[model samples]
Target: MKKLLYAIAVSATIITGCGKDDEPTPTKVPVEGEITGDITANRTLAFGNYTLKGMVKIQSGVTLTIEAGSTITADKSNGEDGLVVLNGGKLIANGTSDNPIVLTEKSKVAGSWAGIIMYGDAPIVNSATAPAPQVATSEDGLSLTYGGSNAAHNGGSLKFVRIEYAGQVITTNNKEHNGFSFYSVGSGTVLENLVSYKGNDDGFEFYGGTVSGKNLISYGNSDDSFDWQDGWRGQENTNWFAYQTGIGNYGVEVETKGVNNAFWPKVTNITLKRAAGTVTEAQSEIQLDAFQFKANGNGEFSNVVIDGYINQTTPTAFTGGAVQIRDLVTYDNQVLTGKIKITNVKLNNTPTVFIT
Candidate 1:
C-alpha cells in the first residue's frame, strides 16, 4: 500500500512540472510619447520618437540611457520644455555619425525651447577665494546649487548629437538658455561631434567645467557661438568650427569672472566665419568680433582661421575684427603673463586682425 501511494505521488509531480512549461514568455514594450517630470529610477529610451513637455529632470542616482537614432522633439507651446540632468545623474547618449541623436522643436524657430542643461560636481573657481570647493546657484532661474571638489566626475557621455532651435529665455531677468550648457562638469565626461544649429543665444556655454569638447560645430546662432566663464579649464579641446549668420556677437567669448588664476583652457584647430550680410545685435552695436577676451579671460588657441568679419550694409564703424582684448586688466595680466596665447592664425578677407 505504501509503494502504490509513492508511485501515485511521483506521477502527480511530473504532471505539475509539465503544466508549468506551457506558460508563454512575456514581451517588453517600448517607451514612446511625451516625457516630463522627474525620473528617479534607471530608464532606457529605445530608438524611437519622443516629445518633451515642460521641464524633464533626471534626478540624482539615476541613469537615463538613450539609444542611438532617437529623436526628441520639444513642445514649445509650454515654453518650458528642456532636459536637465542634475548632479549625480548620468545620461548615456552615444550615437554614431550615420545615425545621430537629434533634439529639435516642431516650430523650427530659434528660442523655441530651452536646451540641454547638465550639472555636475566638478571643480570651479567663481571667485579668487570663496571656498575650498566653490558652489553657486544656477543662473537659469532654477536656482539650484552646483560645484564640488571632484575633478574626475563623470556626468556621462554625449557623442554625435545635434541640438536645433533651442535657447529659450527662462526668466524675465533675461536669463536665457544655451544650446548646450555644462555647469561644473568634469574631465571624465565625453563630448564629441556635437552640433548646435540656429539657436537664439549661445550655441555652447560652459560655466566653470573641466569637460573638453571635440569636433564641435556651432552654425547660424544669433548670439555668440562659443562662450565660457568662471575659469573653465578644459585641457584637451580640438576641431571647433563656428559659422555665424543673421545677427550675432562674438565667435568666441571668454571670461573668468574677474579672477586672475593660473588655470586656462586649451583648444586647437579653430575656424570662425561670418557671412557677408551678417549684422550685430543692434544697428548701432559693433559687437561682431571673432574672439573677445574679457575679465581676465585666458586660453591657449592654436591653428586658427578667421574670415569675413566685415559688415556689408553698415559703415566702417560697424565693421569688426579678428580679435579683441576687451579689458585692460585682461590684456595686462593674462596676455602679458602668457596665459592668453593664439598661434598660427590665418585671416581670409578680414578687415582687421586686432581691434584697438
Candidate 2:
C-alpha cells in the first residue's frame, strides 16, 4: 500500500510538471540580418560606396544615425529621387563644422537631388481644416500624406549639416523646392549651423510650423536666400551673404496665404551683402514685397541690415506698406543710400518709438 501511494504521488508530480512545461513560453526571434536592400530602417545601416536611389522613408520612433564622413550620394542621373523622408522619424546627423554632412549629386556640377524633405505631424497652416498635406509619390498622380496633430510634434534635429547644389525640380507652379525643406516641422525640432552652397533653389524654405533656428549660411544660391510660406512663426538669427553671380531673386521672401492671419516672425541680427559675384559691373541686391504679408497679415522686424550694390537694374530696394510693419525698430546705421522708399518708419537712436 505504501509503495503504491508513493508511486501515485510521483505520477501526480510528473503530470503537474508536464502540464506546466506544456504552457507556451515566449521566445525572442533574432532579426540579425533582416534588412535586404536600400530601403531599410530600425537597424544600423552602413553606407559604403552605396547610392541611395529612390525615396528612403524613415519611419517614426526610429533613429537614423549617419556617421561622420559618410558620403550618402543621391543618384540624380536617373529620374528617381534620392531623398530622406522623415515621417516623424529622428535623424541624428551630428556633423561637425569641419566635416559637414554632404547631400549632393553624382555630378560635380550644380543642381542635384530633390533635397532633404522632412515631414512632421505638427500643426501646419490650415492643417485642421484643409486636406492633409501631401508629398510627391512614385506612382503618377499620387501623393503621401503628412502632418496633423493638436499636440506639439517632435521630429528630430539637423545640426552642422551642409547641402550642396541641391533642389532641381519645380514642385509647384510658383514655388520651387529648397535646399533644406522643412514641411510642417514643429518647435520641438532643432536646426542650427546649416549651410546651403550653390543650390539652384532657395537656401532654406519653411512651409508651415513653429520652428526656430539660428546660424544659417547660404552662399551662391540661385533663388531666394530665405523663404517662409504658409504661416511660419519662427525666430531666426542668421548671416545672409549673396554673390553677384548668384541668381537669387530676393534676400528674404515671406509668403503666407493660408490660415493663421497673425504671421509674426521675429528676425534679429541679420547681415545681408547681396551681389558679391566676380563680375562687378552688375548690381544684384535685396528686394522686399508686401504681397505675402498682405495675403497673410503684417509682419514684425528688428535690427536688420540690407547692404547691396545699387545700379540701373536694381529696383527700389525695399517696397512695402508701413501698416505691414508692426513695431518696426532699426538700430546700428539704418541707412537707405540707393533709390529706396520708407513709407512709415520711426527712427530712434536707441529705443524705437511709434510713428503713429
Candidate 3:
C-alpha cells in the first residue's frame, strides 16, 4: 500500500475568527443518511459503498467530514454528472497515504467517469456574484446546482487523496472534465498531497480562486498536468513526476482570457521529467502565456528543472526558457545541456557535450 501524505498546519493568527484563546470545540451534531439525490446539510455527512446518483450539496457553515477508506461512487451509466457542491461549507477529507480516498469511474478502464466538480458563491472576476452556468446533472438525473453569491469562496481541505481515471467528455469544445475541478474557490481551500493518475483530460483544473498547494503529483494524464484558467492567484510547491512510461502532455500550463484581470500565478520548486514519447515531443514540459492576464498577467517560475531528451523537432520549435540546466541530470537517452531563463543557473557538463 503505497502512501502519500499531506500535512497542513493552518496558522491560527492568519485564519480569521480562529482565536488562540478559543477553547477546543467538540464535534457538531452529525447528519447521517443514505444520499440518493441532492444533499444539503449543516453537519457531518458520511457515505459507504452507496452510489451517489445525483449532486451532493453541502450548505454554508457546515462541516462535511468524509471518513478514511470510504468510497463515494458516482453513477456514470446515465447521462448525469457526479458532483459535490460545497457552497460555503468545509470539507475535511483526511485520507492517509495507505488508506487514500479514491474517486474513480464506474468503468474499469483508464478513462471512464466524470470527475468531481466544485462550485462556490464567492466573488469572481467581472461578476459581482457567482456565475450561473447551466447546472450539471448526475447520471441518475439529478441537477447539481451551484455558483452564486460566493465566487471566491473558501472551503475545507483535500489531503492525501487519489482521483483515478476520471475527466470524462461532457461538451464538444474539448471541454473534457478533470480529476478535480475547482470553480470560484477562494483562498480558504487547502489542497495537498493529491495524485491524479490516468485521466482523460486535465488532471487538475482551476477556474478562479486564491489556492495554495504542495507535494502534488500527476501521472499518465491525457492533457496538461496543472491547468489554470480564469483568474487563479495561488502558490504551488509541486513535484510533477510524470510517467517515465509515456503518459500525458505538458507539465504545467498557465493561461488567461484577456488583460483586464491579473493571472499572476506563482510556482516554486517544480521538477518535470519526461516519460513516454520522444523527449522532445512528449517532454515539451512547461508552457506559460498571459492569455488571461492580458497586459496585467505576470507569471513567475523559480528553482525549477526541465531535463529530458530533445525529441527530433524543427529547430524553430526547440526553444527553451526559465528552467535551470546546470542542476539537471538526464538518464537513458536523455541529457542536460543548456541554460534557460536564469536568475542563478549552472551547467555541469561541457558546453558542447550532449551526454551529462
lDDT of 1 at 334: 90
With candidate 1 superimposed using the best TM-score fit, by how many Å does residue 270's alpha carbon deviate from the native?
0.8
Stretches of candidate 1 exceeding 4 Å from the true structure: 1-31
Model 2 lDDT-worst window of ten: 330-339
The order by descending TM-score is 1, 2, 3
Query: lDDT per model, in order?
Result: 0.86, 0.51, 0.52
Candidate 1 C-alpha lDDT tens digits along 1-356: 22212211232333234466587656545457677899899998898889998889999999998888888999788768899999999989987765578899999999988888999988888888787699888888788887888888888999878899998987755867899999999999999888888998999999897999998989888889999997789999999989898878899999998999898999999999999888877667668989999999989999999998865466645768888888899999998899988999999888788774
Compared to the true structure, candidate 1 yields what TM-score?
A: 0.89
- Name the regions of candidate 2 deviating beyond 4 angstroms: 1-40, 44-50, 126-142, 170-175, 236-244, 258-260, 276-294, 312-356
Model number with the top TM-score: 1
Q: What is the TM-score of each predicted model, taking all chains together? A: 0.89, 0.66, 0.65
Over 4 Å off in model 3, which ranges?
Answer: 1-35, 43-48, 59-62, 121-152, 171-174, 236-247, 260-263, 278-297, 312-356
In candidate 2, what are the lDDT values of residues 87-114, reduced to their tens digit? 6677776565444566667784556666
Pitting candidate 1 against candidate 3, the one with the higher TM-score is: 1
Model 1 residue 308 CA deviation in Å: 1.0
